[model samples]
Target: MVDRNSPIPIYYQLKLHFKQQMKSGLLQPGDRLPTEMKLCRQLGISRAPVRQALTELAREGFIYRRPGQGTFVAPESAARLSQRTTIRILTYYDVLWMASLEQAVHHWNFSHPEQEVDLTVTMCPRSEFHQVLRRAVAKGEAPDMVPLDYVWITNYARAGYIVPLDTLDALWTRILREDLEPVVAHHNTVDGKLYGLPTQADVTGMWYRRDWFAKEGLTPPETWDAWLALLDHFSSPGMRQRWGHRYAGAFPIGTAAGEATLNLLLPFVWVAGGELLDEKGNLALDTPALRRALRFLQQITLERRAALPPQMASYRWWNICRLLGRGITPMTLGGTYEWPRIREESEWTDEADAVAHLGFVPVPRPSLDAPPVSSLGGTSWVILQQSPAREVCLEILKLVVLPENLAAFCGDGLQISAYRSLNRRLATTPEHPWLAKVIPLLSLARSRPLLSDYPQVSRFLQKMLEQVLWVGAPLEETVRQTAQALALLLEY
Candidate 1:
C-alpha cells in the first residue's frame, strides 16, 4: 500500500505496512513473512526499499532474519516492544543540552521501571552536523532524536523527515505551544504545526570594552554616523598610540565564517528596515535598505580602511571575540552565547570583573530616531520520522524541558531560556548577571527567514557580502544578481 507520489519515502511506507499487519494479528509470532524479492514484486516496487524495510524492521525488534531460512515475526514482538526499547540520539557540542538528556533518561528509567528505555548517543562535529544529519535521513538511518538548529526545522518538516508533534500528542503539543516564547514558537512552527522544542536562546550583538570607552569619554554608538565617528577616532594614530589598539573594530564578513556572518550582519539590514522576505513569504532581498547596509559595510572595511579588508575575509567567527578579549580591538560583533569563551580568553577574574570591563549592545541603527535590532539564534530538539520510539522520545523531551532542567541548562551555558516564565525568573536572579543584562533585549530579536532552502539562501547572502566588501565588486549589481539567483533557487 505504498503511495508512490507521497512525500514519505517508499521504504518507510513498506515498513509501516508490515508493522500494521503485525499489530492486527495478520502476521503473528514465528510466522515467516514474504521474502524481499517476493515483497518487491507484490508491492510493485524495487528491491532497495524492500531490503531497507526489512533491515529497519529487524533493527526495531519487529522481525528476525535467519541465516538460511527466511525472515519471521519477532517472538512476542508486540508484547516486548515497550519493555526493551533503545532510543538512539544524535547531537553536537555535547555540552549543556546533552547533560540534560542524560538526566532525563535517568529519571525516565527510574520512574518507569516496567518500561525502561536505553539510550545510544552519537556526537558529530558542529560545523558538519547538518550535512551529516541530511545524509543519515536520506539513507533511512536517521537517529531517533536530534538537537537541530531552529532555522532548519522547516527543511526537515517539509521533506517529511520529521513528524509533527501535534500528530503524535495534541495535548502535549498544545501545552508546549502555549509555553514557548512567541519568537521561539514562531521559528519552530511550520505550516501551523509545532515541529521542534527549543532548549536555549541567544541574541547577536556587539561587545565593547567598557573600561576603554569610559577612559576615552565615549559611549556605545547609537547610530551609524556615530559608529563611523567612533571608528574614525579609534583608527587614528593618536588613539592607537594612547590605547595600544591595533584595529578600530572587527566582525566576520567572509564565506568562511559560514552562518556566523549572517548572525552578525543581518541586524544591519533589519535596522535599515530591510527584510529578506515579504509578508506573503516572497523574496524581497533587492531593496534600498540592503544596499544601504552593504554600502556602509563596504565603506568601513574597504574604502575607509578602518577594518582590514584581507584580514576581514580571512577571520573566523570566533576571531572577533578573541580580538576584543585580547584588547586588540576596541569593539567586536558577537553573540551572547560567546560570553563564556570571551571571558575565558580575556582572563577576567570572575563574572563581576568581566561585567566591569565589558559592555554589550544591540547593533546600532542608521539614524538617531531608528530602533536597534538583533537576530535570534538557538537550537531545538526534534524527533525524526524514522524513530520507532516517538512516544518515548517525547517523554524524554518533556523531562528535558522541565523548568528546573531548562534553568540549569541555560544558567550553565549563560544563554537565555526559550520559556518566558524562566526568563522572568532569570531577569531577577542576581547570580546570572549576564542573562539579566541581555534578557530585556529579547524583545528586539527577530528570527531569520524560516524556509527549507535557507541554507542555500544564507550562502548566497554570504557570497554577496563578500563580493562587495572583500572582493571589491560593484554593490548594486551584486545585490541585484544575488537576489535574482535566490528567486530562481526558490522558484523550483
Candidate 2:
C-alpha cells in the first residue's frame, strides 16, 4: 500500500512497507516475496521505483534474490539497521533462550543510557540458517555477532568472516583463558588465534522414558547390541500397544543441511574408533569403523523397522523434540538444549516432573568395555569482520557474558554454562542436578575436526547417510563416492 501523492519517495515508501510486513510477522524467514513485475502490475508503478527499492533493500540485507529463485526474506538478524547505535545478535536457539538474552540486553541498555548501545537478539530457524547466513555474508550485512557451532568457528575464521578476539586487548584474553572451560576455550581458538567466546556447552545424549524403564525392570543400555535390543523390544506390537506410540525410537536424519544430522551421529563414528581425517589430513571416512556405524543405522531404519518413518530423514532438528514430547518415540538422540523445550512442550512445569519422566544417557558404545562418546554440543559468539562497532560490541558482550549474567542466562534456559566456575557450581547444586549427571560425561565428549572445508564435508556425509538410510543405496559404493568427494574438497 502506497500513497500516490505523498511527499515520501515511492521507493522509500515501498521499503518501509516491506520492513513493517517482516517486523509484524506478515512475512517470515525463507518466505518469497512478490516478483518485481508482479509488484509493478499490482501497484500500477513503473520498474524504476521497484528496482530502486529492491536494490536498496538488498544492500541493507532485508531481502535476498537467488539466481533462479525470487527474492526471499533474509534472516531477521540482517534486518535493515535503523539510524541508531544497534548491534544485532543472531541465534538458532528457542524462544526461551532468546528471552533470557533479551533480558541481559535490556539491562545493559538501562545501565549505559548515556551511551546506549541497542543489542537486538533474533531467532533464526535452523533449517534456513545456512542460506540466511550465506545471503547475509554476500551482501556484507552479517550481524554484529552470531552464535556459531564449534565446528563452524574454524571455517568462518578461515574465510575471514570473523575477527580474532586476541586482537581486542589483554583483559579480554585473560578472561577467556581463566573463566571459560578448557575444552570450550580450546575449540574457540583457531590456528592459535582466539576467534569466539562460548555461550553454553552441551553433550549429546539419548533421552529415554525413566518410568517406563523402571516398570520394565531394565537399565539403560551400555553397548551397541543392548541398545538395539531395547529398541526392538519396545518396537514389538505388544509393546507399542502398551505404550500407545507408533514408533519405538527416532533420530534426526533430516536434510536440513546443518549441524543436526552430524552432531547426533558423530558419537557412533567415534565409538567404532573411526576418525574423519587421517594424520596427513586425508579423508578417512571409508574406514571399517564408519561402515559399521552406517550399517547399524541401515539396520534400524530398513531391517528392524524400529525407528520412525523413512520421511523422518527430511524432518527438521526440532521435530524430534516435538515428537518425543508427544510420546511418538520411546527414545531419541538429542542434546541438553532440548530439556527445557521438552518440559514446556509437554506441559510439565515442575522440574521434578520432567526429571521423573524424561531421562538422558550417554550414547552406547560398540562393546561392553568401550566407553560411550558424546559430541561437543552448543555454540559460541563471534563478531563479524564487517561490523563497524567492534569495540562497542565487545564491551556489550563483556557485560552479557559476565559471570553472574551468564549464569542467569544459561541457567534459565536449562543449558550448561561455558564458564568453568559456573559449571563447577552447577555440578554440585541441587537446582541443576541434571547438569551433575552430565558433568562426568564431558570428559568423554569428542569434537569434530576443525577444518576450513568442514562444511562441504558435512554436507557430503549427510547426503551419504541419507542415500543409504532412505534410498537403500549400496553401502560400499556410496561410502567410496562420498569419500572421494570429500578428498577433492579437502585438497581444494
Candidate 3:
C-alpha cells in the first residue's frame, strides 16, 4: 500500500507496492495490472503519481503496456525478478558509454549465469540532462547509476543524492583509485572518499589545420603574440582566398555555448597565473591575470576582428568543430572529444586521415616560456543513494572498468582513458596512435572548480564574457562587478 506521509515519493512507493505484488505471486507473469485510474483510486492518490509509477515499471521491464489496452506483467517478469537483478542507469547522449555498458552487462551475465544482471538505460538530451537528473532525484526515481560530469560530483555528494563508491566496497575502490590517473582520481574524490568512477578523460585545446600550416610554412602558435600574428595572417584577403577560409578561427563566446565556452576559455586564466578561488575557497575572480586574459579575448574578437562576433556569441557549442571540420575555419577552440565529430563532419575516412590534416595544441600561453594549459573534463559513473541495487551496480561497474573494457570504450569513442596504465598501453598501439599525442596533455590539464554552486558560477562567468565581449561593457568594471556578484551568490 502507498503511504502518503512517508519520506519516499508517492510514485516510488507505488512502484514498490507493485513490485511486492509481483514478487509474492499475486501479480503473476502476464497478469494484467489495474489501470492508472484504478490504481489512483485504490491508493487514494493523484493520477500523475500513478502514471509515473506505471511508466517507470514499464521502462524497467517489470511490466509492458499495449496501446488502447492495459499494462501486464512481462512474460518473463517472474523469472527475471526472482533470478537476475536489473541495474537501472541514466545517462546523457553518449552512445559509446551506452554500448560499453551493454557489452559489460552481456559479459557479466555470460560469465556468471547464476548472478545474471540486466540493464535498463535511459538517455536524456545533453541540454536538459542536469535539470532532468535533479527532477528524477526529487521524484525519488533516481537510477542505480548515472554518468555525471566530473565537476558535478561535489554538488551531488553534498546533497546526499549519490553514494560514495568506497562505502560499497572499500578494497575494490582503493584498487580502482590507484589505477586511475592522479588528476582523474582526484576529480572523482570528495571529502577523501571515492564518489564516482571516471570512464574517460578529455582535455580542452585548439584544433588547427596541420595541412594548411605546412603548406604555408607556418607552425602552431605557442605564445599570445604568435597566436595573434597567425590569426592576422589568416585574416588577410589574400590568405583567405588562398585557403578558401571564411574565418581565421572560431570559438564559443556567449551563454548559448554554455559550459563549452567555459571549458575552452578558462585555460586562459591559468596561462595568466590566475585562479578562480583562493586557498580559503572564496571567490577570486577579480585578479590581474584574469583581467589580462579577458582583455586578450576582447581584443581578438572585437578589436581586431579575428572571428565573427555575431556568430561567436550565438554559436552552439559544437559549431566551432563543425566549422573546422568543413574547412570553413582553419582553427577552432575545442577539445579532444571533438575529434570524432570533426572527422564525421569533414567526412574523413578514419582517424589516420583526420590526423594527417588536423593538429591539436593546448591554448597558447602569454609567453613562449610559459607552460601550456588546458581544462580537464570527463564523465564519471555515480551510484545513486536511492537505488536498491547498489551492490549489483558496483559489480557491473567493476566489469565496465576492466582494462580490456575501458580500453575498448576509450578507443571506440576516441577518448583518453582515465587510467594511466591504459593510456600508456593505448598510446603505443597502432590502432590508437592519436593517443600518443593527446595523452601528454593530461599532465597540464586542470579541472573546473569543484563547488556545489558550480553551475551557477559557470552561468555568471558566461554572462561576464557576453557583457564585455559582445555588449562592449567596460572590461574592468564588468570583471569587478562579476566577482562581487559571485561573492554575494556564495554568501547565501
Candidate 4:
C-alpha cells in the first residue's frame, strides 16, 4: 500500500511496495498488475497518483506495459535495483548469490552503522559479464561488488577492471585458503594476484531421466558405446521427449567459445583420446579428439536422432530449461543448477518428480584410460576499479566468501560452493538431491580456457555451431571453416 502520510514520495513508495511484493512472493515473474483504471478504483487515488506509480514502476523495470496486455511484472532481475548506496551486485542472475549477497550486505550494514551499501541488480548473461564489467569500471559507474566467472578473471584483470584484494590481505588469505590447491586458486587470479573470489561451481554433465532409464532398462552410461546404446534405445520420432539432451539455452552453452565448447564437447573429445587444447589454451580443433567431440554432438542432435527438441536448434541455457520444463525434451546437457528443479514435478503435475525427472553425471569418455571431463560453470565475485568504497567492498567479498555463508548459498539456489573447505558442507544438502551426483563429478571439472578475446570467440563459435547444426554441414568441413574464421579473427 502506498503510505500517503510518509515523507517519501507516493509513487516511489508504490514502487518499493511492488518490489517488496516481488521479493516476498506477493508478485511473480509475468504476473500482471492492476490497470490504471483498476488501480485508481482500488486505491481511491486519482489518475495522477496511479499514472505516476505506473511510470515509476515501469522505469525501475518492475512492470512492462504491453500495447494491449496492460502492465506485467518483469523478471526479478529487472526490478532489483533503484540507485541508492547498498552493495550493488551486478552479475549473473542466481538465487544463491542473492541469499549470500543479501546476508553479506546485511552484515556490512550492521557492522558499519555509519556507512551504507545499497544494492542493485545488473542481470547480465554469462558471456557479457566481462564486457559490461569493464565498461562499468571505465565509466566510473562500476558495481561496488561484481561476481565474475573465474575463467575470465585474467581477461578482466588485463583490462584493469578489477580492484586488488591485497588491501584486505588477511581476510583475502582466509577466503583463498591454502587448503584449496594453488591450482584451484589460480583460476580466480591473474598474474599471481588474487583479483576475485570464486563462489559456487558446476561443470558440464549429461542430465538425463532416472524414470526413463528405469523404464527403458538402461544403466547410467560408463563409456561412449554405452551412451550411444542408451540414446538409440530412448530415441523414437513420435515420443514427446526423444533421446533427451539439451544444450545451453539462456547463456551461450560454451564459453572460451570453443574453449567453453569443450564442456559440451569434451566427453566425445576424451572418449576418442583427443586433446582439444594445449597447456596454453590454443585450439587443437583438428585432432581426432576434436573430431570425435564434434561428431558426437552432431550425431546426437541430428544423425542418431537423440537430440534437443527440434526447437532447441536456437536454444540457449534458459530455453533448454523451459523446453525441458515444458516436457518438450527429457534430458539436458547443462550445469548443476538443475538440482533444485530436477525432482519436482513439471507444470503437468505439481510434483517435481513428475515434471523434471532429473539425473546428471559426467558423460562417459570413449575409454576407461581417458578421464571423463566436464567444464566448470557458475560465477565469482570481483572487486571493481571504479567503486568509491573499493577497500570496504573488498572486505565485503571476504565476508561473503566465508564458509558458513557460502554454504548457505550453495544450499539454496544454483550457486555451487567454490572454497575447498566448504565442498563437504555443500555435499550434505539432502534438499538438493541431484547434488549428490553433482559434486563427485566436479573432480573432473575443468574451466573454459581464459581467452582474452572470449566475446569474439564466443560469437563466432555460436554462429558456426548453428551453421553446422542447422545447415547440415560435415563436421570436418565445418572445423576447417571455423579454423579459417578463427585465424582471421586472431590475425585482426
Candidate 5:
C-alpha cells in the first residue's frame, strides 16, 4: 500500500511494509524478493525508493542476492523473523582458518536450538573492514556482535561504535578476567573499560627447513650474528645452484600496505628496543635501536649480495610463507598462523617427515645475552553499541570463549589461545610438540600500541621501511619525516 499522504519517507514506509510481512511469516526462507521493477510497479512508486528499501533490507540481513540469480530471504532471517529475540553476528572469513569459527557457531546452534541467531560472514580484504562496518553502522544496520582485530578495538570504542562489557555482568566479567591471557586482557581494556573478549593469540617467529639445516651440517641460529651468517651461507651462489632455489629467505618488506608486513616487522623493532611512541605519547622512530634494525634489514634485504631477493619488496606476508612451504625459500620470517597451510602443502606429509624437515623457532636475538621477542597476534570478539540483544550477545560471547571451545578453535588454526590454562594444557600434549616451543615464546610477546591512530602509525612505519628498502631514501630523513606524520595523525 502506497502511503501517498504520509509524512514518512517513501523508502522508510516501503521498508516497514516488507519488514512487517517478514515478521508476520508471510515471507519464508528461500522466497524470492520482487525485482526492483516489479516492486516499483506493485508499490506505484519510482525505483529509487524500492532500491533504497531493498539495499537497507539486505544490509540488515533480511535478504541476500546470489550472482546470476534473484534476491531470496536469508535463511537466518527467515528462521528469526517470528522470534521474540534475535542476535546477529558479523565475522571475517579466510580459507585458512574460518572453518573452526563456523564449527563453533554450529555447536552453539545445536546446543541452543531455541535461540535465533543470524550470522553474516564476509571474506573482504582486511583493509576494507572498517569501511564496510562504518557504512553498516551509518545505515542503522550494524550487527549485534563482531570479531575485530585487537588493535581496532580502541578506535571503535573511542568512536562509540561498541560498548564496554565491564558493566554488563559481574560474574561473566570475572570469568574473562580469570581466563584471558594477561597480554590479551591488557589489550582489550581501553581507557579502563573492557570492550572486547580475546578469542585467540599468536606469536611471531621464524620458520626454517630442518632438513636443509641438517644437510648443511648447521643448527638453527640462536643469535643475530649467527642468523646473518646462516642466511649468507644458504644464499651462496653454489648453494643456490645445488638446491635449485633462487631465494635463500623471504622477508616481506613490500611497499604495498598490509597488516601482515607490519606484524612481521614489529618484533624486530621491539627486540632492538625501538618503540613506536614514547612516554609522552609522541612518535619515537628516530632512535639508535631503530637505525640498527633498519641497517641490518638493508644488509639482508636491499643489498645486491644479500641472501633475500630484491623482489621481496613486492611480496605480501603470506607470500613469504608460501615460498617457504614450496621450498623456494629455505627460511622465512613467519608465525604459527601459516603452520597448517605449510604442513598441508609441503612434501613432509607424516610426523616423522615433518619433524625431520620442517621446523620453527622464536625470532633470534641480537646476541646470546639479548632476549628474544615476539609480537602478540590474534583478534577479539566485540559487542557493538547498536546491538538490541546485548544480553544475548554476551551469552553468545561466553560460549565462544569457553576454555575447551577456545582451545579447539585456536588449535585448529595453529594459533595460541588467549586462555593461559588452555595454552598450559597444549604445552603438555606430545602430539603438538611445536606448542612447547611456542608457548614459552608468549612470555616475550609484545602487543602493538592500542591507540586510535595505530593503523595510520603502522602504515607510516611500513612506508618508512619501503622507502629505505625500495626507494633508497636516506634512513635518518625518512624516519624523521615518518615520525612527523605519525605525530600529526595522532594529534587529530
Candidate 6:
C-alpha cells in the first residue's frame, strides 16, 4: 500500500507499488491481483484510481480480461511478453509432446508453489492445422507454443505467429545440459535465431525388417548398386511369384508427402551430390546430380513399384508408422517419430508379426567419395511476439528443457532434444536401443532449405516430384518446370 499524500499521483504510486510486488518475486506469474473493490478498500483510494491501475495492468498484460469472469494472471508461452491468461495449444500430432511438457511444468510448479501455469491441448484435425493456424493468428488466439514441422514454419515465422529466440541457446543448453541433440542447435534456427526446440528429432531413414534381411542373407545396403540389387532380389520373377521375397504378403515401402516432403527426397539427392539452391538463391534443378537423384527416385517408384501405403499420403508422420506396424511394408523409410506408434499397434492384423518385423537403419547411400548426406529436420517451441509473460515464459521453457527433463520428451514423447549435449547422452542411453545407429545417421542430415516463400516452393516441388513418379512426366521436364516455379517464389 502507498500513501495518497505522497508527491507522486495516486495511480502512479499504485502502479509502482504493484510493479515492485511483481518484480520482487512477491507476485509470481499466475498469481491473480487483488480485485478492484479489495484494492480500493485496502488503499482507501476511490474507484477511479483503482480502475485506472487495473485497466493499465490489463492493457500491459499484467492481468487478463474476461467478458464475464474476473481478470486473471497471464499464463506461459515461449516468451509471454503479454501474459497468456488462457492458452489453448492445438497440436496436430506427436502425442508425447504435451505429457512431457506437463511433467516439466509440474516440476516447475513444485519450485514455485504459489504460482500456477495451465496448459490445455486441443487436437486439431491434422489436415486443418494450417487453416486453423491462420485463423488463430488472425483472431489473436494463437497458442503460446506449438509442435510445428519444418516446412510451414518459415512462412509462419514471416507472418509473425512465431517469435525469434535470439539469445536462448547457451541458457537453454545449460538448462537441458544433457538432452539436446548436437544438430538440433543448428536445425531449428531461422536466420540465426532459434525458432523451435524439439524434445526429439526424427529424420527420414531406411527402416528394414531384421528378420527379412537376415532370412534373405542380405546385409543393409550401402551403395546405390547394392540397394538396387536388394530391390532386384525382392522383385525377381520367382520371388514376385512367391510372397514378395519370402514374406507371406508384404509390399515395398517409401516416403509420403510429409510435413517436410523434401526431407525424404533431398537426402537421397544430396547423397548423390545434388544441391537444390545455391547461395545466391538461384533455383537450378538441371544439375547432373539432381538428374541422377531423380533417376534413383524413379527407379524406386517405377522399377520396384515402391510406394508409400495408400493411407500414408494424407497421414501425418504417424500413419507411416501404422503402415509399418502392419506387415504391409516390411522395409520403409521412417525416423524415430514413428518408433512408439509402430510397436505392434495393429489390432486386426498380426500384432506380434509387426512388432518383431520392425527395425531401423540409416538410409544406405553410395559412398562414391561423396560426403554422406541426410536431411536434418526438427521442431521447436517459439515465443509469440504478443505474449506478455515473456520473462517467466522463458523460465518455464528452460525448466522443461533440462537434460533429465528432456529425455522423457525424447524417449517417452518420441522426439529429439535440440541440445547437442543432451542428444549425445540420449544416443548412449541403453534404453534407446537404436540411438547408436540413429546418431550416425543424423550426421549427414541437413535441414530443409530456408526460403522466405517456403510454402509455395514446397507445394510446387511436391507436385513436380509426384508428377515425375506417379504421372510419368520426364524428370528433366518436371525439374525444369518446378525450378521455374521456385525461382518465381524463392529467388530473393
| Model 1 Cα shift for residue 231 (angstroms) | 2.1
lDDT of each: 0.80, 0.74, 0.81, 0.61, 0.72, 0.60
Model 3 lDDT per residue over 1-492, tens place = 876544234555577678778878889888888898888678676565576567657656678998898899987665666676778888765333554566577677768878888666667666677898889999989888888878889988998999999899999999889989998888899999999888888999988999999999999988888888898899899998998888888888888788888888999999998999899988799899999998898778887764553467878656676688778989888889876556535646455866789888999899977778899998888999999988888888888899998887787557899998999998899887677888889999998999999989989999998888777899999999998899899999
Q: Which digits, one per residue and each the tens of the lDDT, describe model 2 over residues 125-146?
A: 7656667877888998888888
For candidate 3, list the clashing residue pairs, or say none: none
Best-to-worst lDDT order: 3, 1, 2, 5, 4, 6
Per-candidate count of clashing residue pairs (backbone under 3 Å): 0, 0, 0, 32, 0, 32
Question: What is the per-residue lDDT of model 5 for residues 389-425, given as tens digits with 9 covering 90 to 100?
Answer: 8877777677777777766666544567778888888
**Colliding residue pairs in candidate 1:** none
**lDDT (Cα, 0-100) at 420 in candidate 4:** 64
All candidates: CA RMSD (Å)? 15.3, 12.1, 11.5, 9.8, 11.9, 16.0
Structural similarity to truth (TM-score) of each candidate: 0.77, 0.80, 0.80, 0.73, 0.78, 0.71
Residue by residue across 370-447, what tens digits does model 4's lDDT show? 777776666667777777777777777777777777765665443456666667655675555545556677788775
**What ranges in model 6 sit over 4 Å off?**
1-85, 150-154, 166-182, 235-256, 306-316, 344-358, 366-368, 413-416
Q: What is candidate 6's local distance difference test score?
A: 0.60
Residue 87, model 4: Cα distance from true site in angstroms:
3.3
1 versus 3: better lDDT goes to: 3
* Candidates 2 and 6 compared by lDDT, better number: 2
